[model samples]
Target: MTTDAQAGPITLADVRAALADTDPSRTNAGALRKVLGRGSYATIQKHLDAIRAERAPAPPEAPGAVPAPPAEALHAIWGAAWAQAQVMTLARMERLSAERDTALALAAAQAQDVAGLAAEIDAQAAAAQDLADSQAQALAAAQGVALEATARADRQAQELAAARAEIERITAAAAQAAALAEREATIERQTLQAALERQIDKYTDLKAVVDHLKPMAG
Candidate 1:
């Protein structure tokens, strides 16, 4: 009957009838609108306020004292307030959830960057170790070559010393043999001069005896 647009207007009797089965303490205007299916928010609120004013008790005789509304009107106000609070709370929860998702994405990206840097550091350390090993091997080979050269030099020095000693010994033996041959030649020349002087003296004595015998025979 309330949903009929051909009906003149929404009446207080219609609102009172709708409130009969519903608890105003736990419901909002939108849900009541669905049940009635006719009135706009302005029309519903005007009627709701009129009902609350009618239910409020008279002011007390005391000074500065206010009157309390009836239980039904109070519950209706609280119900509208509670509905607004629920809407605000849901919106805030949605914003907080979006911010949390963004933060999680940023943290994941930073972790990937850190992993890449660590890999680069490990590669550099491995390359440095390889270079050190190669240098050590080269130094060992150079030391081996230097040792062989030193040994060859020592052997050559020993051979040169031996050759010099042999040359000096041969020179000393040749000097001794030349001195002995000169002494034997001097002795043979003296013996030949003495034999020639004795032969001349014998010839002179034989000639004098023959001259004396020829003078006696004449």
Candidate 2:
């Protein structure tokens, strides 16, 4: 590397040496800037143009042909135009690279957001499932309680029916006993009346016999 501080001033020789060391396809002011380290871009370009003009094949001169005066200026102008075009190309490439990096970053961020949303949806679904399970359990418990209450009501109804049947049976038995006692009292009264009538007849017969005996004795 030939820096300006070490080489005193960036010259055509310095530009030539940098261009030789660099790949021919990548030979430009920017690449030369890294090797030379201390020249303005315009100055480096001017030296590079001079080097290209020197290497370009000169047209064969006719015998006693006069050298054109404006050819040097035209060569320098064309070299500057070419250098400007290369600089524009390099700038465009750098801009495109930066844009690609930005696009990649945005894509990564979008992926992360999608992942987070997926996780949240899964959590909500799990919560809904848990809520449904709890409601089902509560309904089952309520049904069990209702069935037990119904069973108790049925048992009470059966007991009440049995008690009513027992009351009916006792009433019927008491009615039958009262009817039998009434028949026995009527029979006893009829037998007492008959004995009284027989005694009266016996008394009458005895009085008649006594009267006949008194008359005979007189």
Q: In model 2, which regions exceed 4 Å deviation?
A: 1-84, 174-218
User: Evaluated with lDDT, which candidate comes out highest?
Assistant: 2
Cα lDDT, model 1, residue 120? 92
Tens-digit per-residue lDDT, 1-218, candidate 1: 33354365767776667677555544566766776777786776666666666666789877775788899999999998999999889888888889889988988998898999999999999999999999999999998988898888888888888877877777777776666766766666666666666666666667777787889989
Measured against the true structure, the TM-scores of the candidates, in listed sequence, are 0.43, 0.44
List, residue by residue over 8-123, the lDDT tens digit for candidate 2: 86777878888885544457788799977777888888888787777768999778876776988989999999999999999999999999999999999999999999999999
How big is the RMSD of model 1? 24.1
User: Looking at candidate 2, what is the lDDT of residue 179?
Assistant: 76
